[model samples]
Target: MRRRPPSREELDDYIRTRLALIGIDLSVLPEDDPDAPADQLRVLRSARRVLEQTVPALSDYSLDPQEVPPSMYPAHLPAVRQVAMEEGRPAPAAGGSGRPEEDAP
Candidate 1:
């Protein structure tokens, strides 16, 4: 016997629980209401726009949509954060001397 994937409602509940853990409560959004406020509509649109722009870049860099961890973001990956800490200072730029020009004197 094979395991079944969670239903959409289950996934939504999981996401909402995670959000609530971090002080977000989406209950204020009017569910399927035709008379929802313009400000609310704009917020939803802008959020979608940001996700549209973000998802492709994240996927291009080897992230999967369903693999999104509740507490994670693109730059917040463990390896990336670790590398920053280990560097202790910023990395040198490519083909550029490791110091600012004119101020090196």
Candidate 2:
């Protein structure tokens, strides 16, 4: 026999319980009123769907913990490197030298 996935209500209850654990109370949200538009719940459910699709895809990548992308550069890194070199010490180990603006004055 195959195991069944959780129902929508079950998942929602799980989310509510988890949120409550973190001090978030979903009960604070206004109840669905027949007189008003259903926009709030619709948007919340849409965001949940987006997360469901996004989280798994994001988890697929095996990223290095020490790896830093080339786009992120610390402004003070060059100064640090210069100080290290002046003191007769080796430059610090970092991803891609972490110095995007080394050539820039």
Candidate 3:
């Protein structure tokens, strides 16, 4: 199913909410304040424009939440290596897979 693109108001609301999540609340600034986040807003607007132009091409696809992989947490590295050693598989190199790059399929 195809979804409608977000309205300008919706995008602005999303951007503001994202900023607030990071502790920057644009709403508290006086409307006339010269230091208000114009540059950040401009960049977000540009990004939104790019998305509006590009995303329609992807609307034919459906995304399943279960198909998305979970993110790896950096803190689990040591434990991951220990588990690999326990299982008799060689531990992965510091920043590479266990296999050499040339050997990877």
* Tens digit of per-residue lDDT, candidate 2, span 3-104: 354556665666667777999765655666445554335535755664555654553333333354335654555577678779876654333323223233
lDDT of 3 by residue, 1-105 (tens): 235668988887777787779998665545453476555556566667766765553532333322442354345555676787798776544342222322211
Quick one: ranking by lDDT, best first?
3, 2, 1
Off by over 4 Å in 3: 27-41, 50-105
Query: Tens-digit lDDT track for model 1 on 1-105?
Result: 232545545645665677689998677886555567634344455555544556434533433222555455553444544575587744222121222322211
Output candidate 2 Cα RMSD. Answer: 13.1
Off by over 4 Å in 2: 1-6, 33-40, 64-105
Worst 10-residue lDDT window for candidate 2 reads 96-105
What's the lDDT of the predicted structure labeled candidate 3?
A: 0.56
lDDT of 3 at 101: 28
Question: Regarding TM-score, does 2 or 3 come out ahead?
Answer: 2
What TM-scores do the predictions have? 0.32, 0.41, 0.35
Q: Mind sharing the TM-score for model 1?
A: 0.32
Could you tell me how far off, in angstroms, the CA of residue 33 lies in candidate 1 after the best superposition? 0.8
- Angstrom error at residue 89, model 2: 43
